[model samples]
Target: MRLLLLPLLFSLFCGSLTAAESVRLTNGEWPPYLGEQLPHKGVASRIVAEAFALQGVEVTWEFHPWARSLQLAERGKRDGSAVWLHSSEREEKFFISDPVVESGYYLFHRKGYSFDWQQIGDLQGRRLVGTRGYDYGAAFQQAEASGQLRVNRVTSDETAFRQLIAGRVDLFPMDKVVGFDMLHQHFSAAERAQLSFHPKPLRSDSLHLLLSREVPGNAELIARFNQGLAQLRESGKVTQYLLEIQQPLSLAP
Candidate 1:
């Protein structure tokens, strides 16, 4: 009986080693994506938590300012940060997991203001409202660099949208789903109805979970996360999770 018990205990210990205890990830108040007050802390949060659970791991989240969250994760104070866009600079600093959310940039303008642009060049002379710490893609960045466009950098999406409605900016660029969520939640029906999203998207991007390279076993952790994410996708939990967010539009990739 003792010998049999010893083998069982050893197997359990090995299993524990394979299944890490938990991961602490930092995030910010990205509503409908990640927010403390949101149901299950929002869709991306739900997906990440479920994915890790599939691998017998638990996730703990801490909310901070977006910049600080990234700072903490980059310094290895946290295991990782979630729902960040892919950039070459960031790719060097952290190991990004499989795509967790699909996102794209759209030009949001007042309903009374109709404009058409075939390329970034066509945005010349436009007064734009943009959020701080956002990458609006290379084309927009280059155009901004060359003085082709004017942008008023604000602290939050809410501020940007307000500026747009007040005629402070000709166009505001942001993630379509996120921006619309903000508009729907914060503005009146009339105010929301006054907004229009350009038919042509400015850019398409996906958000991913970023693991700190400085952390030990980071590679293995990402591998486990990817496997779990794939499993979630296969089981259709991923789709259901998105649906639970109550997004106004389908998020199909």
Candidate 2:
């Protein structure tokens, strides 16, 4: 009886240790999906936190500018960063997780600007505004790098939208819902009416968490996150969370 009890006691101790395990991650404001003030810091953050919780790991978040968030994660000051598009350069520096969220990107422009595109080539000579530290998609990236299209980079999404409204750029591509949220938050009702997005999606992209390679044991950490994410998906909670944020919008004037 004493020998059997000893193994049970050790198992309980190890289980408690795993239950207490926690990690801090960096994140940025991209409301309805991710924001400091939003509940559970928005859906993406909530999903990440809950998924880790499923694996008995607690998560804390540090909010910063998107670029700064990436830097902190890259330097291993934090465990990882939530929600970023994939790029070849990032793949080398971090262990990318499974798709954390579905991100539909669309082209936003002023109401007066006539924008149309059938392919990447359609953007030729158009003054496109791109936000830095974001990967629009593979085709757009390839076109921009080869000078087949003209893309002027901005430091933030707000700046890109502002430039578009001022007619400084021919078009601005952004996450469809994120773009709408930004416009509603920063611009007046009239201003919101003056902006519109093309119905065609630029990319139906998947956002992923990036855990830095500089941190020891992060490979295992990423694996755990992916496994937890798979559980979330299998349980149908992921779709339920997404449905809550997709309130019907009257975007057109």
How many steric clashes between backbone atoms does each model show? 0, 0
Model 1: per-residue Cα lDDT over 1-253, one tens digit each: 9988999999999998877789999988877889988888889998999999998889999999889999999989999999898888998889999999888789988877869999998888888888887889989988887888888889888999989888878999988778867777878777777788788999998889999998998889999999999999999988887776655643221
Give the alpha carbon lDDT tens digit for every residue of 73-174 in model 2: 999989899998887899998999999999998988888787788798988988899988788888999998998978999898999988888888878989
Worst 10 residues of 1 by lDDT: 244-253
Best by TM-score: 1
The window of 10 residues in a row where model 2 has the poorest summed lDDT is: 244-253
Q: Per-residue error at 157 for model 1, in Å? A: 1.9
Candidate 2 pairs with clashing backbones: none
TM-score of each: 0.86, 0.80
